[model samples]
Target chain A: MRVASALLISAVASGCSGNQSALDPHGAPAIHMEHLIIGIVAICTVIWVVVMVMLGVALLRGPRAAADTAKSEAWLAMTVVAAVAATVIIIAGLTIASFYTTRDIGVPKSDALTITVRGQQWWWQVFYAGADATPGFQTANEIHIPIGTDVHLRLESADVIHSFWVPSLAGKQDLVPGRSNSMLLRAEKPGVYRGQCAEFCGLQHSHMAIMVVAEAPADYDRWAASQRGDATMPADPDAAAGRGAFLAKPCAACHTIRGTAANGTTGPDLTHIGSRLTIAAGLAETTRGSLAAWIADPQTLKPGNNMPMVPLTSAELQNISAYMESLK
Target chain B: MGAQNRLTERTIANPAPAFVAGALLLLIGVGALLGWLRQPRELRLDPPAVADLDQFRRMPNGISGTPPESYFALGKPYETDAYNLSQGKRLYTWFDCATCHGDGRGGAGPSFLDGWWLYGPEMVSIVASIRDGRPHGMPAFRSRMTIEQIWQLAGYVQTIGSYTPKIAAPSRNDNEHTRPAENRGPAIILFDEGPLGAHPDQGPSP
Candidate 1:
């Protein structure tokens, strides 16, 4: 029993904290929700224990005399009154929490930066909105936002259905085909939060993951500026050869690399693919070797995906992989 | 006792044997209909024809000392059988080839039924058009579609105008890469679909 109590306590402690946990409450919205959750749990637990005690009393003491029967009737009436009072209090508490949560999460900010996230079959296509002074650019899989800033996400799907969910940052929003949904998010501090498609989309639905990078305002500005430009040109011969090979082959057919001849919309944008943390929708690490193997046989890594096995010679693969890595 | 007797007499009037027999016959009919629907559909139509395939094969492109052969070096990739054509038709729709090609009558591109050639009238040219897509319009499918799939699509395109009523795939024209209903496996085939029959480069119908 001691060991069991220890285990229960540890589990509860661990549950209340994690980098990706909603209960941990990294930001204002999640923290607000966390308070309500804790209140509800405490209230429910107390009520449950009281009801169980009452049931035990009623079960243990059986029939009695006439005077005892009259006392039992009075006890029953008191229990009913307590139950009604508890119900009213619980209902009032929940109603206030719901309204407060909505008010905190739904209030839109005028200066919030809008990022359009389009969900595809097994990947994410991210596009940052351009303002009057700055031009917008396209990236994929990963999104970087400034810490403590209201980040508005305009979610849509190119095909099928997908849900964008980052437990630490905000609530889950469904991306339905032919329809656009919007949600707002704000990170309290600089950290990387993992996210995934909460909806069951298709075969590789499990592989459809997301990475949200919360950085300092200055760092985010620098990153955004870099992404706005074309992929840095390769300096060396082998790297240049890789670039040529990428353009010559059908790699351009489904992928787009800004400022390069490889513009095809069927696949993810690879302009900043080299800098991504993971590839194949977070299935593999983003490395030159992984990229080569992915190009050689994508189906082997992610089955039932639309990416065909690109037939490339070893030397060509090496060069192309090098060029891809040099995109940063 | 009276209630029990009445219940027993009613049950006797209804009769379990006749009711069971009727239900059994109904089940048999349903099973037969399902079997008929699931049967493999076969084709009785002639395969699409190509004019002067030999002449096109003989012409050298001057580079690499190797003559430009068809993508499917093994004569015909499929047997042009009913089952194969039906799969090919489904693949055509699966790959969204109908989006620009108008199911073969041509939309953004030229009509395959008109027999007019922007590149050439040979079968190799058609395969080449798909392999390395034509400039400006057709997207290069070499990297996106497997070789066998390309062959299947080519076969389906060849049979476009052969029938008056038109042998067509079900139009699922959406951008979704739908799983083929026939369970022919993944949309992409990495391994060889079948063994080559002695490398048809030597002659036709090896």
Candidate 2:
């Protein structure tokens, strides 16, 4: 009995230790799943041991005693039938229970915030629908949500199929091309949770990562408001020269900087580019050096990307990079 | 011995075995009931339609249709002379194709000097590619460069595309007559100051 107790304790300890990423073990859904699994396993283990012991005793005793063949046959038939029936009943019950649980946790419609997530080849474009229900602030790679609030995401794909998955917050749902799928997520605590593109799109797909920052309601509101506001271009002479180069070159042909005349929509908006955490759709760390390197040769860093290498002298490249960094 | 045998017979004749068998059967029935009770109840919000052969047959492949041929054939051909080829070489350096394609020998893309054509060996295909684009990651150059300049650039590319340098040994020159035009310098310069010529500020010179 002591050995059995020790074994049981060890088993549970190992199970608890094994799941490192299970932040919500005490949460209702996770707890329910764990309880069901443990119960089934325990019952099955007891049955197996009892049956094996009985079979061993029978074999050792031999057929010297009266056979009672008919009675034995009846028992065997009953066991087989009972096992099959039990299996079917268990499977059906589990399926039904899971379905109901999922339904009860269905997306909350009342006062739910709606955000549109568009997946491109190697990036995530996030758009928040404003309080008035108009198209609101747009950002990339990072998604901010208020803690303890239900947020609904309408997932869509711009070019190919991609999946939005932030394991700490909710389960994965695909963003299919030309169609929108909905998901509801609510985080209980304030922290940064990581997400990745679950679907294979193209080159740099593996590099696509997103950050979900769960913030206080006030902080989230401030961030959203700031993103919605116009971009501020620097008035310094070098920056002005850089701006000229940006407009004169092919930069304006693809990227859109909202308050300026650079309004080509082929690439992500760079109005608030200085505030973004990463560049090249989360492929590289957003810094002066990395950003300049990316601008100089995007294909070298992310092979098989749509952005071409624009010709720029070293000094001009520096000026343009500095100007972009000043936008925050 | 007679008494012992009678005792054993009496024990066997009693309801002991029957009681044990009945209890076992009852236990199994109870176990099965418990198992059934423990199973999860599936609540499907949307009940599935009854399975039918017709439903299976109606499924359609939802892939995108093939791209149009005109979309692929957007640019005209270019012709380059030796002087323009030299200038193009300098322009190519400024453009940074060498970073990925290597110094004349290709790395990420096929070598410019190699005759093997992944798309097409002809100058028209090259020009179209420079102007329109390829599927994987090639950006369309129509917005970036003029149509005529792209053609001339294609001509310069062709020159490099067909070139094979002569070996160090003079004996290799014996087959010079059989060598392709790409092996020699560019034939002619097909420069048209590119499409920007339409802009009064930066239009092509007469």
Candidate 3:
């Protein structure tokens, strides 16, 4: 019994707090949302308890005399009216609370940093708008934001509908095709908050995970500066051979590696793929082995996806994986 | 005892065997329909190259040779086949044709729904357009995709710009309701149930 109870407690406690749990909020918007959720739940619980108590009292005091029915009818009518009024008031209260919460969470400021996030079938294409002379560059899957700043996101979809949701940071906003939607996201704590496509977007939806890295302002600036530049030429001979292979194969037709002749728009931009925390939209941790495995057989890792299994020699595969890892 | 039995039987009507059989048949019908709707994944979904594919070798300026006349007409199942069209549709979205083409509406490229064929509405021209690419912004997909895959894409493209809606065209995506789906005919100004004169989706025979 004790062991079962301990296991149950651990299981319940596991979901109470995490990088992606709404219960443990780390941002102003999420904090507001959490408060609203808790408030509504408490209100509903109180109503349920009162209803159960009344039901218990009525059941316990069964078989009341018919003699006092005339007097009780008026009392019963008044009680029903009061109950109806209470229900209306409670519903109105919740509506107002949620309206205010949504307003507070979504209203974007004029000067908020605008980043256009386009949702493809299973990946995210992030384009940071240029500020002054600093030109904007494109990155895939990962979004980096400075802590304690409101960054406005312009959400759009490349194919089907996709929702952008980071439970630890802000509310969920959908990315619809042929239409533009915007959301303001601000993270108070500097941490990696994981997010996934809330909507079911075809076959690889579950593997379509994203990471929001909230860091110090200086650190964010440094990361952004690095991401904006072109991919450096491979210095090592193995990587050079890999680069040659990537260009010669169909990889050049789908993916774009900035600074190289590979300029294709079919797949994600791999200009800084090595710098990302995860590969294939958080399907696996970004490492040389995982990259090689993915390059070898993308169809197996995430089936029904666009990435075809390109035939490659074992040596060619090793060099290509190394070259991909060195893109950072 | 007989009177009592009659009274009980009269009070509650007993289910007829025909009714039970009809209900069972309905359930079976529903199960079959659902099974058909949710098409399960095939064992192999990747593009396996054809051994002999001498297509896309030479032309004036990237226009490949036309598919031979006796191709699918000779016992080969293609074009009108649902499986072939579905594979083509898969290649259509996955290869990012919708990126430049804007889901057949044509963003950077010409619109397929306009009924204006730049290189003629023939399947061979469409095949050449895809494999060899057009003169301007279009990119050749010879290296990336297989010949069968290209043919499938060409077949699907024909259905997109088709004057008459084909039975093999698949449904719309799982997202928000946009324009007329492949199954549905062209939409009106508001959307859906378009005018029947020129619209093939809701034609006179539909």
Best by TM-score: 3
- Of candidates 2 and 1, the better by TM-score: 1
Candidate 1 reaches a DockQ of 0.16
Error of 1 at A219 (Å): 0.5
* Local accuracy of candidate 3 as per-residue lDDT tens digits, B1-206: 99999989966666576689999999999999998986344323333333233232344543334555344333222356666677688778768888888777678887777665566556667777777777888888878775656777887887777767777765456565556776553422212232556554333431
lDDT for each residue of candidate 1 in A1-328, tens digit (9 for 90 to 100)? 9999999999988865667788766666667777777887888898899889978997899766666778888998998998799899888988998788867876357578989999987989999988889899898889999988888888999868899988887777899999888888888999988789999988789999888899999999999999988887799788899998888876786788888988877788889888888888888888889988888667667876767555677999899988887888
Q: Answer with 2 or 3, whichever has the higher TM-score.
A: 3
- Candidate numbers sorted by DockQ from highest down: 3, 1, 2
What TM-score goes with each of the models? 0.73, 0.56, 0.76
lDDT of each: 0.71, 0.64, 0.81
Lowest summed lDDT across 10 adjacent residues in model 2 chain A is found at A18-27
lDDT of 3 by residue, A197-314 (tens): 9999898899998999999999999999999899999998988899999998888878999999999787899999999999999999999999999998887888867776666789
Task: Report the C-alpha lDDT of model 2 over A9-55, residue by residue, as the tens digit.
Answer: 98876644322223333223334444555666776787789789989
Which whole-number lDDT from 0 to 100 does residue A135 have in model 1? Answer: 90
Categorize the docking of model 1: incorrect
On DockQ, the stronger of 2 and 3 is: 3
- Per TM-score, what order, best first? 3, 1, 2
- Calculate DockQ per candidate and list them: 0.16, 0.04, 0.21
